[model samples]
Target: MARKAYSRRARVTGTLMLLVALGAAGCTGDPAAEDSPDAKPAGGEATTARAEPGKYQTLPQPCRAVETGTLDAMLPGLAQLDQEQRQKAYEGTSSVTYDSDRRTGCRWKVDSADAGHLLRIDFERVVSYSASVSDDARAQAVYGDRMKEAELPLPSDPREEQPERRADDSAKADRDEARATAPADDEAGQGASPETSEKPGKGKEKEAGKSEEPADETVDPSAPAEGLEPRLLRELADDAFIDDQLTTSSSGSGQRTVTVVFRTSNVIVTVEYEVQPKQVAEVPDSASMQEKARELAGLLAERLSDV
Candidate 1:
């Protein structure tokens, strides 16, 4: 009996030890199963630190990106200008010229108003003219040419697309034939005569009159025309101001030139200037220019209000 009791005790102890060993094995993974030295994190959570707010915000000046396309679109005849003239118009203290390469087929000059922070304008796809402007004396001599080259073209007149009337002899002949075939019916009796054989001809004439041509789509008289508005330009200039550091100003009789402060938190800033014809010229005895100016001004006003 004593030997049986001892055997039972030994069996219970062995069972308990086996359970504890299994539990430990389950809790601790094998050393071979551990993560490798070069193993990536469990998910795509980046180990790098996050960038601060406004880190990638654009500078608050007239940047190359904004001006380049706008200028090219505004001034189609820019490329034809001479290099000396081009340099004079675009030359500045922080200007850098890049020669044309395989990727970019045209030479370009990039001008910065303040370091690289404010007012970067790129005169691209230009003829190489750095040699002409290298000396101060040469630039002075060609100053007029430079100014002319720098001036951007105004937006094209939208009314130039008006259709012209055809003066072909065939149309005249057709009209003559129609007039000759018409009955000599008076206007008052023409509609009253139900028994008249000319009723079918009149119906055809009515159809022809109806089909002559549809009137053009009605344009909103109050709507502004294409191009940047002066008011919006002023607003943007106003927004570009930083802590009362800069002042806005205008020049020319019709306020043709506008100067504004430009700033950005990331870098230094400076003044940016723009020139526009204050009022489009009016040809004497013709209201076209006056009308156009009014139309353009309305457009400018509308754009400004929207902005």
Candidate 2:
């Protein structure tokens, strides 16, 4: 009976030792096991920033955004050629939009004797659903993408040429005034000293003065100045760009297209103007079309600002 009791106690001791060893193993976690996929963060959703509200809450009617006179100027002969056509041109086709306040567009076209013009204007009011991004920022992104597609030349610094030109003109005017007064002064001095004969010297001085004066350069309004190519514009809105392209039509006529895109606050505006002559060989002028398109864009931008 004593031997049997010793064997039972030994078995009990062995069982206790096995349990203790198992518990110690469980307590001492393995580094590799702790780094397993099961230990990773749940769902793995990264925190993001909240978006801001847009500046513009509403958009204007695209069809009537531009004035009748402006349309007439852009599309010449719309009123003169045909009444039906004039009505059609004045009342541009509005784009179908589920939410007019969010986005809208209008397009108009008019054909004259030898040439035709088309105009399309689009207005978009950006809405930010995200909590982190602002409406203006989103619009800027969209505008940036469009600008990339255009790949236009860099815009010229209007300030750079304008101030220089003004200064030059002022200097030229001052020189002219001085020259005009000089003749009077010379004549008066000569009259006072008629006997002191320096006529040859006076003539030489006048000729030298004339030679030193720079001749006025004739600047054609239609010509785009050096370095002032049609390009992505800045300071017009939050951002803006003008894209001008000349392409040959299927019939071999030259088609000139001028596209202007600008973003003001949370609203974006696009103006597309094109001119194509009936004769395939006749090429359209890019500078004139670009100017007209930019003017139209400016008008539309002003209207958006008012809204």
TM-score to true structure, per model? 0.22, 0.59
**The candidate that achieves the highest lDDT relative to the unseen native structure:** 2
* lDDT of candidate 1 over 1-307, digit per residue (tens): 9999999999999999999999998999767656655555779565654323312122211222233333342333344557775444333233333442101111223323211112222221112244433222332334324333434343456565434423455578899998788778675566344655464477888889988879778973222233422211223311232111111234311212222222122221222322223233411111222233233223322332332
What's the lDDT for residue 131 in model 1?
41
- Kindly give the number of clashing pairs for every candidate: 1, 8
lDDT by residue for model 2 (31-65), tens: 98779766645687545546768778989889998
lDDT of 2: 0.81
The predictions' CA RMSDs to the true structure, in order, are 19.9, 10.1
lDDT of 2 at 102: 91
Model 1, residue 75: C-alpha shift (Å) = 17
Please report how far candidate 1 places residue 234 from its true position, in Å.
9.1
Candidate 1 deviant stretches above 4 angstroms: 1-16, 24-52, 55-85, 88-234, 237-239, 242-259, 264-268, 272-307
What overall lDDT goes with each candidate model?
A: 0.35, 0.81
